[model samples]
Target: MTSFLTISLDFELHWGRFDKTRLRDYLEYYQETLQVVPAILEMFEHYGVHATWATVGSLMADNEEEWRAYMPTVLPQYKYERYSAYRWFDAQPQIWEEALFAPHLVRQLIDCPGQELGSHTFAHFYTCENGGSAKAFRADLKAAKTIAKSKFGQELKSLVFPRNQINEAALAISKEEGFDTVRTNPQDWYWKHTVDENLIKRLFRTGDTLVSLGQKTSYQAPQRNGEELLGLPASRLLRPFRKGSLFNQKRISRIKEEMEAAAKSGEVYHLWWHPHNFGHYPKENLRCLEDILQNFSVLKDTYGMESRSMGEF
Candidate 1:
């Protein structure tokens, strides 16, 4: 059986759209989002699935007082920043919203096993682009880790670069920070020129040959340096995602079939995504998850692949 591994999830909520006005209005839709998070946790608990949440540290700070009421004051610090990947709305609006919502999410993370809280950068900058300057970029990560330690008590280790943007500079800082792994996109040089649907298409890292002339360099797990951070790339999809639902039953069946074949071939198949994706069609996605879980059950029995979070990669 192939020793298979699933990259779990990089769970955060309501990304993709980030306009101030729209963000303010969109906040109304997620009013009940904080409430439904427990159900998502239950799904994983029931399935015996392990996942990693590249936690937004703000999720903890926002709800700090509320959580402290219940948890020890000396909890692990989590990394969440005011202007990080959470760049939406004006600073006040963003801070207010986070203050209202993050505590519950942070508390939810406290006891989850088979999970790792990794750095997703303090500011969700496209370091590869943005001309943000290397010094500025490195400074931002430093601030994020500070927040993570002060707020969550956890040392920032593994990372998932914002949008999987990677380059020599990013590699250097990540290694400096002692991050062991970082997810990277090794598609092509001009692939991300425009942020259209193709933006994701431009993120594929094929055949493990990441450090090609055009592709981002090979990122190893337990990131070492420019070319050493652990690289956990998502496997190929049979087809592009036309719908936003958690993959359907047919896809789950297909994924299971692929895992079976790979186990026979002795290779690692990695699957990953953002958890808030389920929020798009929560009920239907849960159904899809059940299908996927069933297939994983089959895979577990047939192949010896263990579901692993990015920390394990």
Candidate 2:
């Protein structure tokens, strides 16, 4: 098989972070994200990069009533109440439509060339949290598929677990709901477990961005899990561009070297990040992206590296 590059974006504006952040505090950041997504899509088109936007299903709703109409009948009952988006929604008197909902942007992602619209669960469901159940996860997947078909006439075939919390039971439910491909965390020690802030894991994950600390980040191909979903292991995260950071060039160079290795070996290099990562420094981020894509263009010319969406793989 030929070498390939896949990019997936966890495209959940405030919904992804509401549990940890106050919307009012980062209003400007998300506002910039509104502008950044479109520009990012334009660059993807220019670079001929195929990407998947694993979107939060609730963002497809144009209003609160519609959002309510499509919500899963059974919501996740997390022991830690803050992990439940429904509880947060009910507690808030007013919703910031621009920051919380984004049907327009989702539509743009659908119309963009070489883009796949995938699911990030109905409510950014955290499956690994205590009290989460298989029944609730099934309901969440159903709501995700229902809203996508009803609103966009599209079917979701790819999934990315919220916070990279992959559950075996949830994978079975996702396959039954029609998602055939799922993004998995890299097969590295730091990423093998659930999302957490272990000091050592954080330190190593950050260090790996600037230097190799684990196995070769690129892999051969998607593997079939016992649950029957095609597991696409992530290679690296395109870290947000940091202005005047001394290590910025080193980080980009590390990514480029990995891409080259994948290209020469005819392997796959999967890169992912959130659109809001660029919300604060879009210009610098886009420049970093363009630099990376320019490298991909070189590899494409030299080694026939092809760009692919998750579903396409």
Clashes found in each candidate (C-alpha, N, C closer than 3 A): 24, 0
Alpha-carbon runs more than 4 Å astray in model 2: 223-227
Top-lDDT candidate index: 2
Candidates in order have lDDT scores of 0.54, 0.91
Error of 1 at 133 (Å): 2.0
Cα RMSD (angstroms) for every candidate in the order listed? 7.5, 1.4
Model 1 weakest 10-residue run by lDDT: 69-78
What lDDT is reached at residue 287 by model 1? Answer: 68
Candidate 2 residue lDDT tens string, 158-260: 9999999987888878888888999998878998776565989989999999888888888887666665889899999999877778998888899999999
What lDDT does candidate 1 reach at residue 9?
Answer: 56
Per-model TM-score, in order, reads: 0.72, 0.97
Q: Can you write out model 1's per-residue Cα lDDT over 72-104, one digit (the tens) per residue?
A: 222211232332333242244443354234645
